[model samples]
Target: MKNKKRARSYPVVQVLSKTVYLAIPVIILFIVVSWFSFSEIRKQNNLAVENTVNIYQTELGHRLSAITHFIQWTVVHDPILDGFVRENHMGDYRNASNELRLRVSDMQYSTGDEYQYFFYWDEKDIFFNASEIKVDYDTYKEIKEKIRSDVKSKEDPTGSFSWKPFSFGGKEFLYYMITYRHRTFACLVSMEDILSPLYSLNLGENGSISAISPDGEVFYKTKEGPAGIISSVYNRQLFPASKSLLPFSLAIDSRVLGNYGKLFVLQVIVFLAALMLSFIMAGYILVSYKKVILPIKMFSKSLSEMDSVSDGEGLDLTDSKIQELNQINEQFKNLIHEITRLRIDIYEAELDKNKFMIHFLQQQIKPHFYLNCLTTVDSMVSLGDIDAAKKMLMFTSKYFRYLFQVDMNTVPLINEVQHVEDYLSIQNMRLSRSTLYEADIPSECNSMEIPPLLLITFIENSVKHAVPPEGESLKIWIKCRMMNHNAMEIIICDNGQGFSRDVLTKIRNGEDMEEDGNHIGITNCIKRLGLLYDNNFKLLTENNKPRGAKITLRIPVNDK
Candidate 1:
């Protein structure tokens, strides 16, 4: 045992010992420390850029909020504009317009003339700006039309301030409009002027910043190239008070994160050397796994798969490139072969036993059925109905002759169906009641094979229990169809008194179901199906709605 252990130990241990030199630990430690330091630097730089973007977002949001408040206070809520709307005098209009211009001019002066303001009186067709500049009525109408178009295209229902982008005089301006009682007040800021503060920010050599309008138009961008690691801050996210402001985005290029001034080249060289050493270490580890670990896994998997090898098929394990593993696999294969031979012998014996048990079960129901037929015939003869007795005997004779084909484990589906028809006729004659029988057996499924007398057992149960009202006839249906290329289905149902709850439970639980000679026929049929099909067939029984019993059988088929 010690020799065997030593033999298994040499290949794995020797390969590992040779691969792991003293310098390997030093190199690995260096790589780890360097990676941590480099990652920290990049993380810190990215965090700093994100902080700057957030700060800018806040400041820009505050400025826009103040402007919006000023417009609301001066134009929308002022008494001067309200008087101009209500009064019909021309003197009142002139006074209100002058006051509005003065207020807007003062705002522009205070904000370094960054925003242009306009007030339009819808009643008089008059429009004026902060600079007291007046345009022709045609130009005013064009501007009004543009504002209407922008409002229709980009209206924000959640807020009173509606911000939109509109092109006027070949320049795109961010337009902010607020309409109050048919009087419109608006503010306009050029994209270039709005993003002027962002231009002065020191965002590395390859860093970029952009302002995007609500309609996804890029109002302004500092750099025009492929962006990297974008960080975004929407206007509403930054300033909830001014929900209609523009959104901003910033990106810091990956190349900028690696820049370390004078030490940039040296650091790059070190990083590349560390990455190459990591690859070398990974390659050595993979080689060791292939040489040692993989063979043991294959051996374990082969042993596990041996449980399913029942037909004497060889395992045919591949060569594991190791002498000891190969020898172990060969021994395991030989042991499996012996076990398979014994299993096959036992399996054949069990199969023969199952066949005999099925034949015996089939015979168990015969005596009861034959005795009932004979009694029915005797009753007819005593009543002086000789012709009825003769018809009953003829149907019973045909059914019995079909049943006597005990050697055949399966017969064509059409033959089984014919057998069911004979059984139904015999039962009708015996009961002296009319039965409404319907059959829907498709021609495609006529040639498929199924166990003999399989249909009649369910039909017999139906006929015996199918008790309709005084004037109603017993209703029974047999349906057969091919389920797919590999299976067929048979269904038998009746519109009479369905199965009781207790009997259905017994059938589902696979119990004997022999209460007062009640469910013996169905129980025997289930046992026979089990022996013949193993686990390849399905049988189900249920009580149909509004009074009926249904039995469905799905049988697997093999192509001839």
Candidate 2:
């Protein structure tokens, strides 16, 4: 016989490799999304810096413009500047200076000393600070000298009103001057004071703010030497007010964009961790398949090929890595061996039971029946009826011979009917009464085979129970016919008191009727029929219409 090839199992590595194949596109997608997110973060940071710089520029420009307007108005409207321009004598200067000093002192007292007010007279060659009496002598002298030197060395303004950048003690200030013929009025504003609100701004670790000149020189900065991919906003684009006045620019660092490097590092770490986990899980699955799933498949295949325990004596076995699976395999093999041994024991037990039942049936008819036959035969001989005695002896010999033929499991229907007739004749002669016996057996049914003594057992039951008192005659009917193509039916009935309800109920239910050693003939007949025909035969016992016990048997027959 040609053997069919078994299919190969799928490799676990190939299954795990599919996950790596799927991850390639996912990694690409992740990078693309992260790039867009980084770009958006940069753009938002730039916008925030631009907004902060613009706000600062607007406030500073507004303050400078207001101060300039107020100084110009006071110079044009007050009589102090007119006195300085028209009078040159020291007395006249002193009288006018006293009134001017009182007015300037009043102005300084009205507003905080955020500015230093100065006045200059070209003819008198007098350059002095009008509101300096309140300042410390040394500090005031230092500031006055620096301003005096710068004012003298400085070039004259190209316009009547002009702005200039001034530095004093490392602080930035804007110097404003107004020229009225021979007299000049000017004031100094500290740039640091104007920008003080932004000192507490929440710029990141590597972030800063700076005020720069148009020439790229830093006037003031919050932090020195700021580092990293810092994004900045220029004041020229958002706030143009500072362009004409020294063209200073405000700059704010957007440090949020610089933090992208840390974010990207975190993302890479997470991706690598996930990849490592996937590898571990794949390895686990492979180990489980080899140790658990593979062994189970082998066990199932072995079971499928097995026809019987004896035939499968050499079962395919493999040691599994798992202890529980090995134990189960051993237990399954032991169970098969146990089942094989139990089957032989059960078969021998059934054979012994059949032999014991047959032997009992053979012995059952001899004891009481032999004594009755002897009594009848003795009586016959005593009357000098020698021919009757010989007839009775011949019939008894045939009856005992038939009853003892335990080896003949089945006999032809005609032989069983003949044995029954002989038994009935003996009973009639012994009782000295004639019983009516009729047989309606067809020629076809006479050759049918049935269990030996099956029909006679029922007939004997009728003779024992249905034989009436001396006056009334007993009528026995035996009928046989073909029931179907493969079966025959036999019916035996007798006109007498029918079976009691208790006996009929026990018979129909197939309950034991031989518990008291009674009805052993009928019990043995049923057991022998079961042994011969199994379920293919049917037997029915019921009370006939009118008054009699009826026994019907349907037996399967071979064509021969």
Candidate 3:
């Protein structure tokens, strides 16, 4: 046993030990690369944020300047202003005011809502509207006083405008006041209209944008908060420097800046990939021990323990820890079933040895296999799939008997197709309605002999990767037809996530290296086919239109 253990240990333990050292440096390299990637990403993002803020502020400046110019041009060029201000050409004040308001209707601006228009006469110290517009005078008076106070406080008010929020009658308005050449103009805009642009900007998740007065009062804040408290408290984290929109400067949250969400997700993916690759490399080395060495041990032990032909009849290994043991155990269980079936033939072996040998290698189906099937049947019955489970139970014994009876590991294509259908029926009941499979093969092709479980591998791939999410139907199609020159063609197509280019490439090359859960099962099957067919087979793979993937294989119709 010790010698056997040492013999089995050499390739895996020695190679994996060396490979582990190589993986450490590769892991470190990834970490350094990831660090630099995040740094560069953030550096670029900061530059982008700074540049974007500058451009936005510049554009906003232009927009505000346009509004400033509009107000300034309105006051200076008013035909009626000459009559009212100079006290010379006043025929009727109402008619003049009506004319000025009509002229404003022809104006175009970016804002969707209208702005309040008021004219201030410096000499009379009185305010008058260009037309009768709905505004709460008391609220406007308070906001106007705040603006006047702010303008008075400023050392230089030229080219400057004051704005403040005022609310009345359950509606909020922003009052913008500018003093122009012996007169003042106040424009009232709804608060919603002013903050609409800020709301639309893609400020990162948990980040917000707002406008703050010179006195540090916030009147325009984006309303996305359960953690509004964070914005209130984390002033240090704020990027309060997008060039002032006249009387107020814009503040954006820049502390957690630069697409941190994407960067962190990328880092996690890389870190996990590296870690998984390391483990997979180690796991791949252990496959030789699991597949070859362990099976030899199981067979040797089974052969040794058999005292009589009857003692060998129940040699099933259920004690092994390795998952690979299950396959060898199943083979032994089928072998025992064949022995039980040929018990009477063996008694007559003294007369015809060749006939007994042939009968001893095939099936009667083991009790253990039947017990497992019944247990599964009981489970499905409890889950309300009693009818489907009953049908599967009936097919289970027949499938198992046929599965063991295939003399040289090959069977008629019809039997293989029926086996797959029965398997699908059982699996479909287990995962009710999530997947639907359809098989279409010409009847003439049914007699062709192919390796057992060969086609099922591709079918199983479709099952795992192609199932749609809830409320959506997943469709899988298996089609086969005889091809030219004594060849058979089979296609398995599914409407799943489809294969990635890397996975498709690996499968096409028959390399069982993918750890993506979906790719591993497929390429393993391809590897088996390569061993079986050598260069006699042809395989093609491609992504299907709109969704899913297609796998096509061509093999000789004659099993020989």
Candidate 4:
């Protein structure tokens, strides 16, 4: 009869098994596709940023070079500049300077360059060819001095020049100076000519350009101030001795990348929605299989085997075509076999429980010894020395309190630290020696959780095994900090005799040693860690340099 039922149940199990195997590959394919898509998107985004930088850099370089070339042409060909220089009359020079300044300003206005629209020339103490405005003589002298120094030391005469602050029009200017020399002319061209080209060139929405003369004077700038640029030039080392090109950087107030970020956010929303839909469909399929399909299929197949059941013969449906359903039917037959085995297991489990109870009873002897020690403490309280008795009572209370607080398997790191402090306070009293405990815990991780008693146990062990002899002080240092976004580390180190080789070996192998009373605490700690966190919590015991011990516990931030 049992064999007949077993044969009848085989096909259903086989069918379910085959379906699971097929589903695994389908799930893997989905995950692979999603990962590849995300990776490709990220790569494209980075490439876009690099391309934008390169485009702006090239455009700015071309515009600047063109402006310099135009200035060289103007200085060589302009008849007004020639007339002013040859005549050397102040009135003629002033008229020529005004006219030339007007021309430069008109050119700038026509080209829509709003950064700069003025030109100036300084010879001795007089300013010439300025934009119809008289510049301060002292300001021009300062500008001239800076320009002269830069030109005299320049290794590359034709290159675009940058300068520090030099005076112009009573205000400081960071200017770019270009000197032009022809057969009959030698003159300096301020960065006024480039303002038109700079304004016309596209540098994205937030990008800017500031041209600085070799004398640290401002010649032309798309931005308002040179403080940011001055800081950059002074602090950052410039590369390539020939042409210096600073890449166009995105502005802090830019709204351009907001659109791209929004697109990425939209993609995330869609991906999550698709994943939720897939989970819902998968859950529905699983529910249908468990509630309606499997049972109905089993009942239908069982009806076909009624004839074989009545004939008192063993049926053979194990070879049915549906392999998974057949295996499930076989499992039903095996369940009866499992029931008989379970009876034998129950008997074995009872014997094992008895043995464990015996072991537990034997371990109760240690607590009995602790209780007797407490009685002695009570007697001491009855005597005159209340302080000594109070110390003993406090230590006993803390030791038992920690052991009894089993409800708190995990606690906030701050609570664990408090427990350590309580333990240390009692230990310090018991030893009657000054023990320094330095705690530097970051505020961010104060509320982060960790396994209870994990850190305190190590600290207690250090106080127990590493405290120096009479008349000597002990120091225990502790620091609790977050390693990154999702992990916190506790470092507890002491300065006393370090652990011996034999003790270190015992800890590594998870062995409990009977030689030292201190070993019991460490062993219990290891066991508790195993039960609470499995293999996730790490406890390391090592020797400190020269002498002493360092015990570090690293727990995952979200493990609890």
- Give the alpha carbon lDDT tens digit for every residue of 1-560 in model 3: 86665444233345456667767777777888677766666565556556666666666566666666777777667665555555644456556666666655444335223666666655555556643456577766655565555455655544645456666445666666666565666667666665565554445556666666667887666644326555542222234434445545666664333555667777787877687776767675586566447656876786677665463455555433334454666687677778877986766754454343243333123466467667778887888987768786777756676666665646788888887776576566555565677889887788888877666667767776675645778787889988865889999888877888887777666666646456565665555555556668888889888888898889987743
Worst ten in a row by lDDT for model 3: 356-365
| Model 2, position 541: C-alpha lDDT score | 87
TM-score of each: 0.50, 0.42, 0.37, 0.49
CA-lDDT, candidates in order: 0.69, 0.69, 0.64, 0.57
Writing each residue's lDDT as its tens digit, candidate 1 over 77-196 gives: 778687565556877777777887788777777664767777765666666664433444564566667655544454452236645666665555667877665566788776667667
> Model 2 reaches what TM-score against the true structure?
0.42
Pairs that collide, model 2: none
Prediction RMSDs, each to the true structure: 11.2, 37.9, 23.5, 12.7
CA error at residue 165 for candidate 3, angstroms: 5.4
- Candidate 4 accuracy as TM-score: 0.49
Q: Which portions of model 4 show Cα errors greater than 4 Å?
A: 1-74, 102-122, 125-328, 331-372, 378-383, 386-460, 467-470, 474-488, 505-520, 556-560
**C-alpha lDDT of residue 44 in model 1:** 56
lDDT at 403, model 3? 60
Query: In every candidate, how many clashes are there?
Result: 0, 0, 0, 44
Residues 376-419, model 2: lDDT tens digits: 89988999998988989999988888777745656788888889
Residue lDDT tens for model 4, 89-132: 77876777667666666655633342232333434334333333
